[model samples]
Target chain A: MIIKNSIEGSFHLTGGDFTNAGIASSELKSILTELGLDDNVIRRAAIATFEAEMNVIIHAIAGTIYYSIMPEHIKIIVNDMGPGIEDIELAMQEGYSTAPDWVREMGWGAGMGLPNMKKNSDEFKIDSVVGEGTTVEIIINIKQGLR
Target chain B: MNIHEIASKLSLDVKTTKGDLEREVTGCYISDLLSDVMANGKEGDIWITHQTHPNIVAVAILKNLSGVIITNKRVPEEDTLKRAEAEHLTIMTGQAPTFEIAGMLYHFLRC
Candidate 1:
């Protein structure tokens, strides 16, 4: 086993598997939590990562989520090759979702994914070019000396 | 309240395992979205949801929720029930909608 506690990892999310969408984030949460992070910190990291993961499936057909863990910070990157957000401001608004009815029927697509991620993370950045792709980077600060 | 007593109070049916009804609940959260539940629901909380997907069980495990109560007279998929049972998470079905079940749970926990 790779005993890299402060390790960076990446996940390739295949959009076809709605059943397995959040599994990656779930596993990541367990690993971080077991490393003795605070519950609140873990929740923030998990929420940010899971929302990003779900967005790739619900909007884009595929994407990748990458993580970098250090003693004082956790950084995440989500890049998707889906329909790019035309208006970044509009996409960031709460309760403004473009997901179809079917996705809404599954209890997601509430327009809260991005907002939730931003709300939970200490630092958030989004860059998108129309007709190209969207990439989001989130940084969460872990207390100093936390393993 | 114990899960069984809540079931009796709400007149709900045990849709999954009989052994699970006796598990104790510490709190409750009502949400249909798995993400919200995972983000907000505390461990030992009885999750009241209208969803019947296997992902619900996965969320329960991730959040460490005590059990799940499926409201609105909807039965969970067979695989979902089996997964819940395997995880030892209580699963119940209630005739009332999600809101009603939430109200009852709130009163019970408050009392």
Candidate 2:
């Protein structure tokens, strides 16, 4: 189906499933490209999605990633079912990971995921509860009047 | 060195589709963590690591890497290899340890 005006897509992520974490982001990248989004913008959004996807698999037991592609901006939302962040500021730091040993050995938990997401996206916001869950929203503004 | 020469020089076994052998490779990164690989690796680069799993392939796909090399005689999971082939991503196996493979890759790129 041809979507002329805008595009919307969502990817479900299951927690503790390291194997399938990035598939949704990959598919989203392809769809965004087909929708004529900028390459750099697509890359930025994909990076944010990839990190959020990984966090759900590594930290939460389950989560869902929601995204929308517009002519001028791309929006991504990630929601996870797990013990939410205790300190949002500390979590946003570059190297304050709470991942376990195995996850660290896997070359993650360097405490870079959240910072990286913020660095890559043009607009970034986070919401969390100590015992409820976490939701992150990232947006990339597509440069105007560009092919 | 190009992937063709690297494959021939190391006597590595390539498990990639025909199209991948022709893709241009700029450099290589050696890391065991999928997160580090994703954060540091660039497009058109080969990733050398000991961890062999579907997640490695996932990182490669996300980064749009040139290919992947699982070192120290470690072969990727069956499904991982299959997906790599299907995705037209170049993949290879080597008996050298991770550090040794990294050295060889660095030496090759330097010369």
Candidate 3:
């Protein structure tokens, strides 16, 4: 999928690279802020991006996150090469996580990543093939004075 | 109340010297789970958690939170401190547990 928007960027994430995991979301947040988006809108976008970024770091061997800022909406696409989920419905359920104990010790892997992403985003979609990869797309509509 | 005043009132140990101590604290949210904070935490609020990692700093910055209060005398890791400093995020240490700090902050902010 191609986003023919005026602003676009991609961030590459290495699996298990916990130290640099949140950088992509931070950059996206700054971009949205620069665009003068509403605070609440920006916050939701950042949360969705951050959760997707963490999912990549914890599950995938490597991945790339692409973001586009359009006139009426902001969209983020996260594609990761990892052990794809066997059950998408189960994964979307809150408090359902396969993250290891070590990941949980880091204060993540609480089974809230995917659910929270869906909650914060206006539209969310997930696609995955077991043993292949997973892709998540999130879109947040732009509204004026909605904060 | 701002971070400086809250810290003073609660007797929190200021860990970093880089962030804005005067940043106003509009509310407080206590949780160790990153997603909970992401979904529920509001901007300019104080976050109380026992998790001390770089990701916490990222969440604080992403949510535009005013500050992070690490409970139970837990010291932030070196890398966490570095990120917190780079982001200009206020991070404080408190000997009280999460519940105690949360209660105190709740009463202080509410009253």
Candidate 4:
């Protein structure tokens, strides 16, 4: 599916920057709200982007999130450089997490990040290579007249 | 019940006035885990948690929560307060523990 009317933006993320993990999602929420998208769609996009952003902060060395908003859908791609996931299938489990103890102590890393992202997104894709990096792409469809 | 009424009944300290006190409270959710709240919390629900970080505000905004009540007198971080103010999110502090606050909110909302 191709959307004709679209707006795009990108943000650079630094690894271990827990303090600023949600900035991109916050900005995206505002952008979506300003564009008058449905509240449910905005919420889903925000949650998915926030989870992906948290993953980048907790696990990657550095990353960038590229987002595009269209009348029909929103697309977000998060690419990171770090030690990638060894087992993609296992990682999708609800309670599976590799976050360190310190990250868990911060009330995160309950192994819900990827699962929650997938739950909120209409389409979710994750690609990773060990010792190289991981990339996550999510699409949230904005249904018309579904408010 | 509205946020102000609930706060008054529970004797919650109004830490920040960024959010509307008159906003109606539909329900309440108690948790410190951000993802749990995001996944299960309903819009207009007040979130009760012990976590005091900027990300908490982010989560509250995403969930469209009516307000956030921080239990045990734990203050929000400076950055959290700033973000809350910017987002117009209510941040309240209570001297009681999570259990007590949750009970009070439940009783107040029920009434």
Best by DockQ: 3
In model 4, which residue pairs have backbone atoms overlapping below 3 Å? none
For candidate 3, lDDT tens digit of each residue in B1-111?
999999998999999899999899999988888888888898889999989988899988888899999999899998999999999999999998888888888899997
* Ranking according to lDDT, highest score first: 3, 4, 1, 2
lDDT of 3 at A80: 96
Tell me how far the alpha carbon of residue A59 in candidate 3 is from the true structure, in angstroms, after superposition: 0.6
* Positional deviation of residue A107's Cα in model 2 after best superposition, in angstroms: 3.0
Assess each model's interface with DockQ, reporting 2 decimals per model: 0.53, 0.59, 0.85, 0.73
RMSD for all candidates, in order, please: 3.0, 2.4, 2.8, 2.2
Say which docking band candidate 3 falls in. high
lDDT of 4 by residue, A1-147 (tens): 234578999999999997787888888889888777778888888899999999999999999999988767789999999899999999999989999987876778989999999999899999999999999999988857134
Q: Whose TM-score is greatest here?
A: 3
DockQ of candidate 4 relative to the true structure: 0.73
Candidate 2 lDDT over residue span B14-109, tens digit each: 976643676777888877767677778898898888877777787898888888888888877887887777677778999888777777778887
lDDT of 3 by residue, A1-147 (tens): 222465888999999999997899999888877777788888889889999999999999999999888767888999999999999999999999999998998889999999999998889999999999999999898845233
Candidate 1 versus the native: TM-score? 0.87
Q: On a 0 to 1 TM-score scale, where does candidate 4 land against the true structure?
A: 0.93
Rank order (by DockQ, best first):
3, 4, 2, 1
**In candidate 4, what are the lDDT values of residues B20-94, reduced to their tens digit?**
999999999988778899899999999999899888988898888999999998988998998899889999999
Candidate 1 regions with alpha-carbon error over 4 angstroms:
A1-5, A144-147, B18-23, B35-40
Compute the DockQ of candidate 2.
0.59
First chain of candidate 4, TM-score: 0.94
